[model samples]
Structure formats: structure tokens, C-alpha cells
Target: MGIVLNQSLKNTIITYLGFGIGAINTLYLYPVLLGATFYGLTNYITSCANVIMPLFAIGMQNSLVKFYSQYKTIDEKSRFLSFTVLFPLVLIIPMLLISLYFYDEILYFLSKKNEIVKYYVWLIPFIGLCMAYFEIFYAWARVHMHSVFGNFVKEVGLRLFSLLLLIAVNFDWLTVEGFVYATAGLYFLAFLVTMFYAFGIQKPTFQFAMPSNSKEILTYTFYIILSGSVANLLLDGDKIMLNQYMIIDNIAFYSIATFIALVISVPSRAMHQIVYPITAKLMHENKFEELNVLYKKTSINLQVVGGYVMLGIFVNINQLYAMIPKEYSGGLLVVFMIGISKYFDLILGNNNAIIFNTKYYRAVLFLGVLLVAVAIGLNMLFIPLYGIMGCAFATLLSITLYSVAKLLFVVKRLHLYPFTAQTLYSIIITFILFILFYFWEFPFTPVLSIFLKALLITLIYVYINYKFVISTEINEAIDFVLNKIRK
Candidate 1:
């Protein structure tokens, strides 16, 4: 927990910093500078890329994390690392060739509804390939317990560059189309930087041979591909669906609301970087007792922190929407729906790591695939009736159902659960805070009002959690920060 805490805190700070920049870009600059249509197009390109990224990488990122700790000899580890690096190319090359062969068909399918997407259709695979390799290398770093630097590059570096690019657009240095192309270049740059950093951490021996456990490795990688696709589909499939069913500008609105809601997941995202490899190590060693302890601790800890984030956002959602454009304000319901779903995911803690590392992962992945279908079906059914709000409803329901299924599967199969008494207490605290803050606001401008309200909420939330000691780990963390401040 000590290493997990140290690295998780750093990753959390880096992630929030990135999200802050993303908020500025998504909520203000993109809308203000590029206008809603191009803003939506920009998001649409990235969302489509993310949805296809797993197929390109063929699951090497997850395979690295799950298998890296199992090898005892450096030669064996080197062989495995080399395999992870090289294996994805087998699928990537063929996929690119296929895309080239079917280029016109692909463009027609993507642009049938929206012609603006036709010009940018090529960027999806290019960017997805970059994203895929970046994760493969980023996973390379995580397996060695060197996640902070990769995380900094991932969370802070890309968003910071995006901020600069938007400013470039503002200064008339780059046209909007150029901004889109340059963003794709940024993805490539991120991949290159991470690849070099990963090599710096463990200079790749670049063996031509496969790992000794090639059969097991290949099988796991196959399942991971499905799992990764399912996960990404859950995250970004709605946006792609929106591109299909609605106008491109609506996606910009959905993007804004979703971005605000996504801040709740930052703690889970941060903790997963460190906790995932540790969970893999524990599973490899058959350390079920330690694994169980970790399961409970991560659950309660993330719940406390994620609850705070969700609370802050939900309570102050009005002010947040106020700061954005009026047309985008209709996404208020999207925020509530998506925010709750993200909070539900956060409380599951390392539930994903536990499932992914276990043998039952195949069954869980099958369930995930089914839920992806369900999600798409739901979106198709709802989008015509409602709008962006309908997409949000579909996302919320699909994610919640998926989350509950994962939770139940872990409990039924492993006999481990992520909840304790603290889970209930944390929920109660969150509920109370929401009721108290949701209906009131300081009579000031949105920025100042948000600051004062967030400050009040933070102080009160921290005090109650500290007093009740909802999580001993959280309490110790608070005390540690306070002691450092006193010195």
C-alpha cells in the first residue's frame, strides 16, 4: 500500500492537472475558438480512434502487465518484452493493408451521414495505431513499477500540447483543419516519446524468439483484445454512435458534459497504474489473502476519494454549465447520468485488475462483449427519442449494468468483494453533501462561486471523513499531508 499510495497520489495530481487543461480546452477554448461543429469533429475523430485502438495493438499492453512478473530470468523477460513489442505488428500491418484496400468503402461508411468526417476518416486508423503503441510502451513502463513518468507524459503532456495547439488556432497560426492534423501528430509524438522512455527504463534486447509460454501468452492476448475493445467501446462508442445518429455539433456538447463527469474517475485511473501491476504480482504468487486485503482497501479508499469528486461536480454542475456556452447547457442531464456511472466504476476499485488477472477473465470478457452490444442497441433505440440526453442514458445504464456484473462475478468466483462498512458510510456522506450543496449557491460569478463552494465542500468533506475515519489509509494520508504542512 505504501508504494501504491506514493505513486497513486502523484498520478492523481498529474491526472487532475491534465483534466483541468482538458476542461479548459473542451469547455471553453474549443467551443469559443473552433465553434461547436469543428469542436465536435475533433472529438469525433479521437473517439473513433480510441474505439479501434485495441484491435491495432492486439492486447499487448495488458499482456505485458499480466505476464511480466512471471518471468524469473532476465533473458526470459527480455524475450517476452521483445515479443510484446513485435507481436502487434502482425495484426497492425494487415489491418492497415486491409484499410488501404477498402479505403473508399471505409470512407463512405464513416461519412455517409456527416461529410465533414470524410476528410478526417484517414486520421482514425493513424491515430489509433499511435494510441495502441503508446499503451503498449506505457504498459512496458508500468510492469517495471515506473508508471509516474509515463503517466506524466500521458496525462499532462498530451493535454498540454492540445492546449498549445488550440492557442495556435486562436492566434490564426493554424487553420482548424491543420489543428486536427496536428493533433494526430501529437499522438504520434506521444508514442515516440513513450517508446524511448520505456526503452530507457529497460533497454530492449530485441530478441527474435517468442516467450517460452507462447501458447498461454497468445491465448491471454486474444482474450485481452476482446476485453480492451469492450472497455473502449463502453467509453467512446457513444460518441461514435452520436456521429451516426445526430449532428456533429451535438457531440461537442456531449463531450463537454462527459469531460466534466470524467473527473470522478481520475482517482481510479491513477490508482490503476500502480495497483494493476501489483495485483498481477499478487495473483501470480497465489497471494489470495493479500489480494483480498488489497481488494477491500482499494475499494474503500477510491470510494472516499471518488465520492468527493463526484459530490463536488454534481453539487456544482449548474455553475459548471453556466461557464460553458448556452447551447451546450442542455447537457446538464448528461453530466448527472455519466457522473454517477463513473462514480460506480470508481468504487469497484481494483475489481478490473482482479478479474483481468484471474482465469475467469475469459468469461468476464464474454459478458463485456455482450454488454457492448447492449450499449449500442440502447443508444440506437434511445437517440431517436431523446438526443444527447438519450445517449447519456444509454451510457449510464450500460456502464452500471456492466459494473454490477463484474462485481457479482468477482464475488461469485473469487469470493472477494470490494465493499466494507466504510462503503455504506461513504455513500451516506456523499448523499448528505449532495443534498446540502445542490440547492444553494453563493451569489457571485460562476468562477468565484465555484471556487467558494468547492472550498466549502472540500473543507467540510475532509473534516467529516477525517473525524469518522471512513478509511484508515485515507486518514493516514491526510495526517501525513498535514504533518508535512506543519513542518
Candidate 2:
């Protein structure tokens, strides 16, 4: 818990900083500078890339985390690492070749509804490849218990780079088309930097031979690839589907609302970097008792912290929409639905890591694939009927159903639960705060009102959690920060 809390706090700060920059870019600059058409195209390109990234990497990133701690000998570890790096090429090379061979047909298929996407179709595989390797290297760093630097590069570095690119667009130094191209190059740069950082941590010995556990490794990688695809599809698939059924501009509107909603998951994202590998280690050593303890602690801690974020976002959502363009303001319902879905996922804590690392992961992967099919079906049914709001509803229902299934599976199979009495108390606190803050707004500008409202909410929320000691770990963390401040 000590290491988990320490690194997660730092990662949370970094992630929020990135999200802040992303908010500026998504909410302001993209809409104002590029306008809706190109802004939506930009998001569309990236969303497509994200959806295909798992195929390119072939699950090496997750495989590295799950298997790295099992090897005792450095040579054995080196061989395993070598396999992770080289194995993906088998799939990546063929996919690229296939894309090249059917490039024209692929373009026609993707751009049938929206012609703007035709020219940028190539960037999907290119950026997906870059994303794949970046995660592989990022996982390399995480397995060694050095996630902060990678998190910084991933969270802060990429968004800051995008900020500069947007600034370039503003100065008329780069056209919007150029901005899109440069974004692909930016991902490549991130991949390069992380690859170097990972190598510095453990210089690759380049053992070309496969490890002795090749059968088991290959099997796990196969399931993980499907699992990763299912996860990403849940996150970004709606945007891709939007491109299919709606005009490109509506995606920009959807992107803005989803970005605001995504803030609630920051704590979970930060904690997962460190916690995934630790969960893998615990599972490997059969530390069910320790694993159970970790499960409960992370659940309560993330619920409390993530609940604060959801409160802030949900209570002040109207003010947030007011700050964005009027056209994007219709997504208030989108924000609420997606925000609730993310908060539900947050409270599940390290449920993903627990499921992915265990032998029963294959069962969960089957369930994930079925749920993704359900999500796609829902999107197809809803998007044309209700536009962005309909897409949000589909996302909300699919994610909620998927989350519930995962929670139940973990409980039924492992007999471990992520909730305690503190969980109920945290939920009560969150509900109370949301009700009190949701109806009122300070009589000032959106910016001032948001600041004041957020400040008031933070003070009261922190006080009650501290007083009640909803989580001993969180209480200790507050004390640690306060003591540091006093010194």
C-alpha cells in the first residue's frame, strides 16, 4: 500500500496535468482554431488508431507485466524480454503488408460516409504501431517498478507536445492537415523516448531464443490480445462508430463531453500503472491474503478519490458546458451518463489486473468479446436515433453491464470482494455531496463559480473523509502531506 499510494499520487498529479492540457485542446483550441470539421477528423483518426493498437502489439505489454516477475535467472528474464519485443513483429509486419495490398479498398470502406477520413486512413496503422510499441516499453518500465518516468512521458509529454502543435496551428505555422500529420509524428517520438528509457532500466541482452514457457506465454498473449481489444473498444469504439453513422463534426462534440467525463478515472489510471505489476507479482506468489487486502484498500481509496472527481465534474457540468461552444453544450446528458459509467469502473479498483493475471482470464476474455459485440450492436441501434447523446447512452449501458459482470465473476471465482463497510460510507458521502452541490451555483462567471464551487466541495469532502477515516490509507496520506507542508 505504501508504494502503491506514493507512486499513484505522483501519477495522478501528472495524469491530471495532462488531462488539463487535453481539456484546453479538446474544449477550446480544437473547436475555435480548427473548427468542428477538422477537429472531429483529428479525434476520429486517433480513435481509430487506439481501437487497433492491441492487434499491432499482440498483447506483449500485458504479457510482459504478467510474466516478468516469474523468471528467477537474469538470463531467463532476458530471453523472455527478447521474445516480447520480437514476437509482435510477426503480426505487425503481416498487417502492414495486408493494409498496403488493400489500401484503396480500405480507404473507400472507411471514408464511404465521410470523405475527409480518406486521406488520413494510412495514419491509423502507423500510429497504432507506434502506440503498440510505446505500451510495450512502458510496460517494461512498470515491471521494474519505475512507472513515474514513463507516466510523465505518456501523460505530460504527449499532451504538452499536442499543446505546442496546436500553438503552431494558431500561429499559422502549421495547417490543420499538417497538425494532424505532426500528431502521428509526435506518437512516434514518444515511442522512441520510452524505448530508450526502458532500455536504460534493463539493457536488452537480445536473446533471440524463446523462453522455456513458450506455450504458456503464447496462450496468455492470445487471450490478452482479445482482452486488450475488448477494453479499448469499450473506451474508444463509440467514436469510431460515430464516424460511421454520423457526420464527423458530431464526433468533436462527443469528444468534448467524453473528455470531461474521463477525468473521474484519473486515479484509477494512475494507480493501475504500479498496481498491475504488483497484482501480477502477488498472483504469481499465491499471496491471496495480501491480494485480498490490496483489493479492498484500492477499492475504497479509488472510490473516495474518484468520487470527489465525479462530484466536482457532475456538480459543475453545466458551468463546464457553458465554457465550451454552444454547439457542444447539448452533451450535458452525455457527460452524466459517461461520467457515471467511469465512476462505476473506478470503484472496481484493480479488478482488471486481478482478472487478467489469473488462469480464469480466458473465461473473462470470452465475456469481454461478447460484451463488445453487445456494445457495437447498441451503438449501431442508438447513434442514428439520438446522435451523440444516444451514443453516450449505449456506452453507459454496455460499460455498466460489463463492469457488473467482471465484479461478479471476480467475487464468484476468487471469493474476494473489493468492498467493506467503508465502501458504503464513501458512497453515502459522495451522494450527499452531489445532492448538495448539484442544484446550486455561485452567482459569478463560469470560471469563478467553478473555482469557488470546487474549492468548497474539496474542503468539505476532505474534512468528512478525514474525520470519519473512511480509509486509513487515505487518512495517513493526508497526514503525510500536511506534515510535509508544516515543515
Candidate 3:
């Protein structure tokens, strides 16, 4: 438990470091320089690539993590690793070829406005291949417990490069076309860096002789692809559908709203990276007691950490929106809706990592697919009437359903519960903080007000959690800080 908590903390620090860079790139610079429509185009392009990558990936990336520990000899593991890279290439080549053939009709249906749709034709493949391989190598690194480097590449490396490119555009050093090209190029570079790092750890050699377990791996990959596709639909499908049914600028607005809300997932993201492989190992060893402990601690720890972020965002939403133009300010409702949705996910703890890496992943994913379909249907019906807000409501409803379904599955199957008195106490504390800070007026510039409010809310949240001992995990964290000060 202590080791897992320590790893989770380290992962959170690096993850947030990446997100700190992303927060600036996504929330501020991209919107300021690119404007909403162009920003939407960038977000849309990335989202499309993400959705497509997992499809063509043929699930080898996931198979990499699950199978790595099973191989006794390094030679055996190397063969599995080689297949991880090759299988995806074989699958992705045909998928890309088919996509290129149908590019025009696909673009026509995906875009309501023709202006940016043309870019998608070529961009999709570049983005898809870059994203797919990024995950492939990232999975390799993760199984080795070297997840932080790949995370830095993902969280900080790409955004930092994009920030520079956006600055270049602002000074008229590059055109939007150049910036888009640069953005797409950065993703490939990030993937390359990840691959290089992965190779440093374990240089995979392509060998022809099939492993006796090749058929077993292929079967697992097939199920995982279905699972991955449904997961992407839940996460990325909203932006894709919004782009299809509405204008590009609308996606920009939705992108910003979603970006703001997505912050709540940062803690979970960091924790999950380390937790996934560990949980997989535990399950493989039939260590259900250890897994149960992990599930509860992660849920509590994530809730405590993510709850503070949600409180900060909700309390200071008005001031935060003031940082952006008024055109983007109307996204506050979207922010709240999505923020709440992420909050629900946070409370579910590592329910996702637990379920996705376990034997019962397919069943949980099927339930997720059902909810995702509802989200699509709702967004299709309502986005025309309500625009980004419709998208927000659809996302909120769908995410809530998805999170609840995940929680239920974990509980019923594992006989585990993440909720406790501490969970209720955290909720009460967040609500109280929200009410108190909700009405308080800090007379400062919008930018300054956000900083001041965030600081105060963070301090109060920690103090309250410490005072109440919200969870043993956070209490121990506080104690560690205090002990260092005393020493």
C-alpha cells in the first residue's frame, strides 16, 4: 500500500507537470493565437486521430502490458514485444488504405462546413499513425515501470513544442497552414522520442518465427480492440460528432469547455499509469485482497485530490472565464457540466484501470458502449438545438452513466466498495467550501482573482481534509509534510 501510494504520488507530480504545460497551451495560448475556429480544428484533428488510432492499433498496445510479465526469459519477452509493434503495423496499413479510398465521402459526412474538412483527409493518417505508435511504445515503457518519460513526452513535450509554433505564428513567422503542419509534426516527433527511449530500455527485434501463444495474443487483441473503440467513442466521439454536425468554431468552444473540465482527470491519469500494470500483475497472481485494497485507496486518494481541483474550478469559474474572450465565456455551463462529470469519475477512483485491465473488461466496456450510444443519440438530437451546451449536457449524462456503471461492476464483481464515511465527509467539505467561496468576492483583476481564489481554496481544502482526516492516505500526506517541516 505504501509503495503504491508513493508511486502514485510520483506519477501525479510528473503528470501534473505535463498538464501545467498543457493548461497554458490548451486553455490560453491556443485560443488566443489560433482563435476558436482554428483551435477547434486543432482539437478536432487530435480527437479524430485519437479515435482512429485505437481502432487501427488492433489492441497490440494493450496486449503488450498484459503479456510482458508472463514471459520468463528476456528473449521470450522480446518476441512478444516484437509482435506488439508488428501486429499493429499490419492492421493499421490496411485501415489507412481503406480510409484513403473513402476519404472524400468520410470528409463530406464529418464536416458541416467545408473549410477545415479538407485538412482532415491527410491529417487523419498522420495523426492516427503518430498516436497509435505513441501508445505502442508507451505501453512498452509502462510495462517496464518507466512510465514517466513517455508521460513527459505526451504531457509536456508535445505542448511545449506547439507553444513555440503558436508563438512563431503570432509573430508572422509561420502561417496557420505551417502551424498545423508543425503541430502534426510535433506529435510524430514525440512518438519518435518515446520509441527511442523505449528502445534504450529494450530494443525490440523483428523475428519471423511465430510464438506458440501467437493465436492467444491475437484473440486478446481482438477483444481489446472492441473495448478500446468503445472507450474512445465515450471520450473522443463527442468532439468528432460535434464537428460533423456543427461548425468548426463550435468544436473550438466545446474543446475549451472540455479542456477545462478535463483537468479533474489529471490526478486519475497520473495514478492510473502506475496502477494499471500493478493491478494487472496482482490480478494475474490472483491477488484479489491486494487488488481490493488498491481499488479503495485509489478511489479515496483520487477523490481527495481531484475534489480540490473541482472545487477550485467551480468556485472561480467566473474569474477563470474572464481570462478568455467573452465569446468563449458562454462555455461556463459546459465547464460545470463536464467538471461534474469528471468529478464523478474521480470518485470512482481507479475503477477504470481496475476494470480495463481485468478479465471482466469486456462486460464493463459493453455497458460503456450502451451509454456511449445514448450520448451520441442525445448529442445528435440536441446539439442542433443547443450547440455546445447540448454537447455538455450529453457528455454530463453519458459520463455520469458510464462512471456509475463502472462503479457497480467493480463492486458487484469484486465485492469492493470505494465509498465510506470519508467519501461523504469529502463531499460535505467540498460543498461547504463551494458555498463559502461561491459568494465571496475577491476584488482583484480577473487573472489575479483566479490565482488568489485557487490558492485560498487549495489551502482550505487541505486544511479541512487534514482536520477531518478525510482519508488515511491524504492524512498521511499531510503528516509527511508537517514532519518534514518539524525536522
Candidates sorted by lDDT, descending order? 1, 2, 3
lDDT of 1 at 385: 94
The 0-to-1 C-alpha lDDT of every candidate, in the order given, reads 0.94, 0.93, 0.82
User: Per-residue CA lDDT of candidate 2, range 1-487, in tens?
Assistant: 3889999999999999999988888889999999999999989998999989999999999999999898999999999999999999999998899889999999988898899999899999889999999999999999999999989988889999999999999999999999999999999999999999999999999978989999999999999999989999999999999988888999889999999999999999999999999999999999999999999989999999999999999999998888988998888899999999999999998999999989999998999999999999999999989989889999999999999999999999999899999999999999998999999999999999999999999999999999999989999988888999999
Candidate 1, residues 342-371: lDDT per residue as tens digits?
999999989999999999999999999999
The model with the greater lDDT, 1 or 3, is 1
Instruction: Give the runs in model 2 whose Cα sits over 4 Å from its true position.
Output: none
Off by over 4 Å in 3: 1-3
TM-score of each: 0.99, 0.99, 0.96
Q: How many backbone clashes does candidate 1 have?
A: 0
- The TM-score of candidate 1 is 0.99
Better of 2 and 3 by TM-score: 2
Candidate 2 vs. true structure, TM-score: 0.99
Query: Which segments of candidate 1 are over 4 A away from where they belong?
Result: none
